[model samples]
Target: MDFSFSDEQRMVQDSMRAFARAELLPKYTHWDRNDEFPREQWLKMGALGVLGLRVPVDQGGQEADCVTAGLVIEEIARGDFNCCYGILNSCFAGDILGKFASPAVKDTWLPAMASGETVLCVCLTEPHCGSDAAAIRTQAVRRGDSYVLNGEKSGVTLLMVGDAAIVFAKTDPAAGAKGVSAFLVPLDRPGITRHPYSDMGARGIVRGSLFLEDVEVPAGNLIGPENGGFSRVMQTFDYTRALIGLMCLGAAQATVEETVDYLKQRQAFGRPLSTNQGVSFPLAEWSAKMEMARWFCYRTLWLRDQGLPHTRESAMCKMQVPVIAADAVHDCLILHGHYGYTKDFPVEQRLRDVIGQEIADGTPHIMKIIVARDLFGRDFV
Candidate 1:
């Protein structure tokens, strides 16, 4: 199989890289320091066709394939890891809305989201559930023409800034995953409240808790078949996990590149640090591992585009990439000596940011379970 990127893919990567360098790199530190979301930059990215990559062209998106979407995400993360979370949410949520939402809901939200006029967040994890999505406790009870939602969603990305959310809740409390449903709830509703988290990294994209108390949502906002919504939404993660891997890899790649340059120039023991076998060998090893992980991400995306079964591959990407990236960033930090420990260099921040990815989307343990279950029968695994 040919492993090369097409000209169009190369163009997408280059364009996104240029945009990140011009728009994100300069302000990344400021955003990190102030814990400020770059709302303006998000808007600019929307104008650049970055926000709606997964949505079809008719729906105000670029109609890019999964591989191209991953490239855009990776490039953006290279400049500011926090910003990629917004991109991920926009692409993931937009794709879901485009496919499952009613035409009116699509017409209303897709354009606004594509243009960055609105922010969208996904509410899945509840206070009691993290990786085990089937155990979510949030409830959406039907009431004539609407659904009354009452529960708390924790660790919701972009909740503070989001205009709306795609929430998953249990419609049939007695049933397990099959009884779950999804809804597109507008955050302006009276019964919704948000509390932000002061996280160690990715501060620009605030992680928060969303509380719903008798939040009434119109029946028209239901995303898909009531009980079937759980399975449908879970499928989206097969695509998103690879993108998340790429995002983390991008940040780590940037850190590695910076360290390589630093080692070439910094003298130690009467020679450049790169001349030492200790420094060079480990960096070489990490470089190799990172390259392998990068290709794994792209290949998984390509398989998704080909309409192949990629759940196991996607799980592998998500499971391994973040850990690899964390190691790369950590090694790069140690190689930088005292300078890396300070906030003066971006390595420290990259380290914190990439570490969080190990837990984001899905943890390594969860991913391993997925891969194992796929390889062995569920009963055996």
Candidate 2:
């Protein structure tokens, strides 16, 4: 099997890497330092088509393949890990809307979203549920031409600055997972209120909780069909899980490069820190692990592009990559000595930023359960 990227893919990868280094790396720390959102950078990314990788070409997007999208996010993450969130959310929103939303909904939001003029967030996790998404208590009741929604969705990334949310709620509470339905609800809706969180990492992404108190949206905003939201979201998660792996890997890879540079220039006992096996060995190990994880992620994305079953592979990516990335960044931090602990260097912030991903998407525990279920049969697991 051919493992090489096509010429077009390589060109896109190089261009994104250059963009990340020149534009995003310089100001990566500014947003986290001031607890500010990277709105301008996000807009720039939109202008660069980074936010539109999953959108259709007719909708002003590249409509790139899944593997290509993965490549773009990985390169972007190297420069600014937090900015990668915009691409991640956009890809998720683009795919969901492109395939399911009504013509009006698609025409209005997709182009604007591709242009970076608007942001959309997925609201699935609730104050009471996360991996147990089916247990979400958010309710959306039909009201003639609209659905009146009421529920609390916690851990919504980009919520504070988002224009709207793809809110998943139960239309028929008795049906459990089957009862869940997805809606594209504008954040400005009368009963919608937002509360931003003061997260330790990825603060620039501004994750928060969305509270819908009798909020209303036109019935046409329904994504897919009623009672079909759960499976749709699960399928989406399979795609994003692979992206998450690449995203975290980019951060870890960047940290490794930075550590290598520092170690070579810094001296210990009249020699560079890189001369020591102790210092170099950890970096070596991490590099190898991250390389393996990166290929696994790309293959998972490849499987997706081929329309093959990769739910188990995606779960493995989610379960293993972030932990590997976090550990690699942590070691990179330690390798930098006491300086790594300070905010003066990007390593500390990278550590903080990378750690949050360990919890985001799906926690390792939840991911492991998915893998286990697949391997041992659903009944045994």
Candidate 3:
């Protein structure tokens, strides 16, 4: 019944909100225009302890709960949507490595990643397969003391600047999903080539493809069991699906607030535009939708904190919230008229940024399948 955040949660939220407005918002467009990575801001986020919320305290991270991590990402997205990608990558890498990686691997990467001295990316999607993740063609074969990996991973976020990658490859192709394994491969290793994309939005993060040819790593780099990586990554996605919802909602909410101010001062037909229900009702409607979606996402993250069944809830958030956020931003752009189309206002950028998320974690079609399978049971579905 209690819906309010705790004192500690409030403190974290207030600090991140202020940091977003002061440090991140001012330079948000600068990085996009220049096609540069926000390394300085990434370090600042590390110093603030936001980058390691899911990493263990013993491993140089805050090791905060899932709900607190959700708050941090949402607030940051309000200032810079692309920067939220860093938080997402860190949390995924932190949780997966802290729990399952060997001491040597964890010792080398976890602390540096938490300190923002290095970055890690998850390599699951391939050029040939995205939604059907199990059908990936990446292959890893065991040698006497090392595993040789050869595959092309596409649609990776932050790959251009990633120091290492949690690469997933098929160790037993006949076993389907159970045959997959994960490895911590340093990007500087030989036989690795990277190619960056010219994305329409969020160009600051620099999504790219990782081509691995005969890349070798020690056996100790294997995460979890020999064939347990598929389930481990899917579990991590459940946590991130809710986070994605909040991230998009943050950007949309900021646009809503900005449009409200613009509407009130804008004169139309010798009267303020805010006076007309036609001009104001869409904003009001989208506001209510986003508010409802925001609370749902929070509840989903809370369920994760409590270790409850939330796969269905997480899929629902992924399925609906981003679409709602994208629609709201598109409508807000229309409201801004000619100015919204131009880079003069952030609305246009927000629209392009928000749309990428609609396809990132899981498309609506795939998410629908997850929810349907849950509702009717696997056999029935």
Clash counts per candidate, in order, are: 0, 0, 0
Model 1 local distance difference test score: 0.90
What's the alpha carbon RMSD for model 3?
A: 0.8
lDDT of 2: 0.93
Where is model 2 more than 4 Å wrong at Cα? Answer: none
The lDDT of each candidate is 0.90, 0.93, 0.93
Residue-level lDDT tens digits of model 3 in 1-381: 989999999999999999999999999888888999999999998889878889989889998988899899999999999989988998999999999999999999998998887988989999999999999889999998999999999988999999999999999999999999999999999999999999999898899999999999999999999888999999999989999999999999889888999999989899988899987999999999999999999999999999998899999999999999999999988888898899899999899899999999889999999999988989987
lDDT of 2 by residue, 176-264 (tens): 99899999998998998999999999989999998889998999999999989989989989989999999999999999999999999
| Model 2 steric clash pairs | none
lDDT of 3: 0.93
lDDT (C-alpha) at residue 54 in model 1: 78
* Cα RMSD to the true fold for all candidates: 1.0, 0.7, 0.8
> Candidate 3: where are CA atoms >4 Å away?
none
All candidates: TM-score: 0.98, 0.99, 0.99
In model 1, residue pairs whose N, Cα or C atoms come closer than 3 Å (at least 3 residues apart or on different chains), thus clashing, are: none
Pairs with steric clashes in candidate 3: none
Clashes of 2: 0
**On residues 1-381, what C-alpha lDDT tens digit does candidate 1 reach at each position?**
899889999999999999898898888888889988889888998898888887767779887899999999999988888888877887787778888899888888888888888999999998888999999899999999999999999998888889999999999988999999999999999999999999998888888999999999899899988987788877889889999999998998888889999999999889999999999998899889989999999999999999998999999999999999999899999999999999999999998888888998889999999999988989998
